[model samples]
Target: MPASAAKSTIALIGVPLELGAGAAGTVMGPAALRTAGLRAAIAGLGHHVVDEGDMDVPHAVPEFAPGELANCRNLSDVAAWTGEIHDRALSLLASGALPIFMGGDHSIAMGTISAVSRFCAEAGRRLVVLWLDAHADFNTPATSPSGNMHGMSVAFLCGEPSLTPVLGERAFPALAAGDIHLFGVRSVDAEERRTLVERGVDCVDMRMIDEFGMSALLRGILDGLDPETTHLHVSFDVDFLDPELAPGTGTTVPGGATYREAHLVMEMLHDSGLVRSLDIVELNPFLDDRGKSARVAVDLVGSLFGRSIVHRPSPRA
Candidate 1:
């Protein structure tokens, strides 16, 4: 059983700009989450909510080295953003507040997770990541064809050399390769596929979702968690859901988890109480209609914070 973080203060820190991804519109995700009433929702659960507001991220226009993968672009600004987020995340952890990182893109995980890793290393606790995304996101400079940094978040976090300098003095802290779990993956490039396979990464893809349903997958992941783990950061890319359910993401994959399926995962996560931090990334409001995607994401986060569908009791005739 994991020690509950009930007494901890929760901070909603938004990185409301996206130069780190292949598309636009996700920069609006931070505001969307707040507009969807994140602070109020979390407070509804009897927890104190504090909105630290958005972090200081650079504009998408590039200034730094695009590096070996020129196509990925934004390398310099992304690196600088890492430094900014690293400082903020470290402060949040030291302050004992459970920081819920509102994302501009998945790239910020490289910063948030890295800070958590460093804290855990010194304080003596394990770091666990539940990477729930549609794509594998393991691409490196050599392996990546498109060179998008969002596609390489997992690769960078695992201490891949292509992103070392981006670690920015925080390189000493990182998680063991086996501690990360890649769940709900369906799309994979040839290089990412090979790397994930060779690294012995635990990936429960859409096929598995089809074969066993979400309950079994949740059971397997929860079973792997321990209370001693310092933090369980859930990096949820909206693309993990089928485009039918979540259509506003940069990367849209077919056959995603239905609403009920997504709700169940969040509900179970709430039950486990292992999750500490989170990322709601890849939601592109520019591509959405009447804020459909934003609303769904809000509902899902509600489930994570202990909202349920069984609020009413069945009546007998």
Candidate 2:
């Protein structure tokens, strides 16, 4: 383990939220990750790992009018989960332990990143989100063809007006579009793409990766951050991996990061020591080929936390 990672405390928060997606099995994502030894993997890398169990949706939630946000699937359920997730995430961030939000789907990010943005603002730090996914989740209610909340999470985090009430009465600092960097994206809706361009979201799609290479593109992101004042949040949707590598995710896109490429990304992140929070989302065990995807996720996380083949001097040292 790198010196920066040694003896660090890591909190694992399971969110069994599948309402944001169009699939049912994503509800089991947290369990699959646990079954794959997520705790042991991090602990083995010399971190103190705390399993915070799972967060359940609030039973009583605000009721919305029938025609209000009607296109969004399971609006009420997602609202309940989002509020609960935001509160819990805020508490976790304040605790000084690095939190890894194990997710039911990418929608959980709406809460996690919201909490991060708020924390960064209060702490006088800039929040930079590195969105690792096959799709740029920049869809709003009006732009989303499927109206899945998972697809709309980034927009909500970026302060899309219509979805503001999803977090209920809580006022979280919305992320600036320039602070978001979408990586490994190969699939994007037409309107979502337009929105991403119009909003000036930094999207490093597969074509860009092929041209510039992952290390160069990723370095361009990491090197630009002012480490002293930046709170880096990495939202890693499992579908960021090639569907052939991680077919267990609900929204699998074909051309995604390769195994070695994924490890390099993790290793680089570990070297940078800029990551303060993480989200491992969109793993559906029911669709997994005998837990293969879960194991891969665990391995990548291991690298992220400093599980390396050989010891390398810390770059910051």
Candidate 3:
């Protein structure tokens, strides 16, 4: 634990549905995070922390027509989780507590982001998503090499036609392409790369981080926001950290953010006071080395909620 900051209610909702990923262990992610003391870390920062225990696996709805999206694996199960999460997320947002969605996999964003998008629209605010991940996650079904639904979450949230039905009659206000900023990206599928450029999505790849540094690049993103009218949702994928530091996730990629570099990003986001919601995804504990990854993730979340080594004046002040 570090120093405490302002008091706020922080709700932890665990989504344990991992049918969207290409691996078996992400379903254990939520429990790993809890065991790593995620709730206590935030509470140590003077926030009122509520632990809404892991959500039960939703009953798969028989909503998809046969062969509608044949390429996507576990399509119906993913759709069920998406719809259930969207409803739960919307209710949490309405309660006014900052929600940290502890995920089973990255695919849960299809629901969480959709809820945030709707909430922002109703409040007349712009929703800007800072997607911190190793992969862009912008692939459509046609473009995905592995057919894993987790790979297509960003595309689905942006209203890719084929995935719209995943929400199944839920109100979805598609996020604008410009509102999304993908950071820490290093591995992008070929067609996913093309789609990202064509859609004009803002991406700060690892090469850019290496060239410009995290502070300068992140400041460019933070400087453009209007704190009064924007809701910042941070979707943090564990693979964004270098594999050497956090080797828990199944989708480990080389040359990711170092420990201090990741902390700087979180510290900066905390100072901005613009983060309204967050997702910590893709921690597959079975792949971890003696719970190392979960502890790192909890520490990062602590920084995001205003834990620091020394008292620093608020940049907003």
- Which has the greatest lDDT? 3
Pairs that clash in candidate 1:
242-256
Candidate 1, overall lDDT? 0.79
Model 1 alpha-carbon miss at residue 246, Å: 1.4
* Per-residue C-alpha lDDT of model 1 across residues 1-317, encoded as one tens digit per residue: 34233434688999865777888888898888888788888888777889998986545423545556565566777777877777788899888887888887888888888888887787777788889899888898788776668888888888887678776566656556678888889899988888888888888899998999898877887775665555688888888877888888888988888899998888777767687778788878888767778788888887877677675221110
Error of 1 at 103 (Å): 1.2
Off by over 4 Å in 3: 1-5
lDDT of 3: 0.90
| lDDT tens readout by residue for model 3, 165-232 | 88888977998898999999999999998999998889999999999999999999989676777899
Query: TM-scores for all candidates?
Result: 0.91, 0.97, 0.97
Consecutive 10-residue window with the lowest summed lDDT within model 3? 1-10
**What order do candidates take by TM-score, descending?**
2, 3, 1
Model 3 pairs in collision: none
Q: Per-residue lDDT of 1-317 in model 2, one digit per residue for the tens?
A: 32234568999999998989988888888899999999999999889999999987679777888664788888888988998898899999899989999998899999899989888889999899999999898888788889899999999999998899899788988888788999999999999988888999999999999998999999999996766677789999999999899889888888899999999999998888788999999999989999999999999999999899999865744
Query: How much lDDT does each candidate structure score?
Result: 0.79, 0.89, 0.90
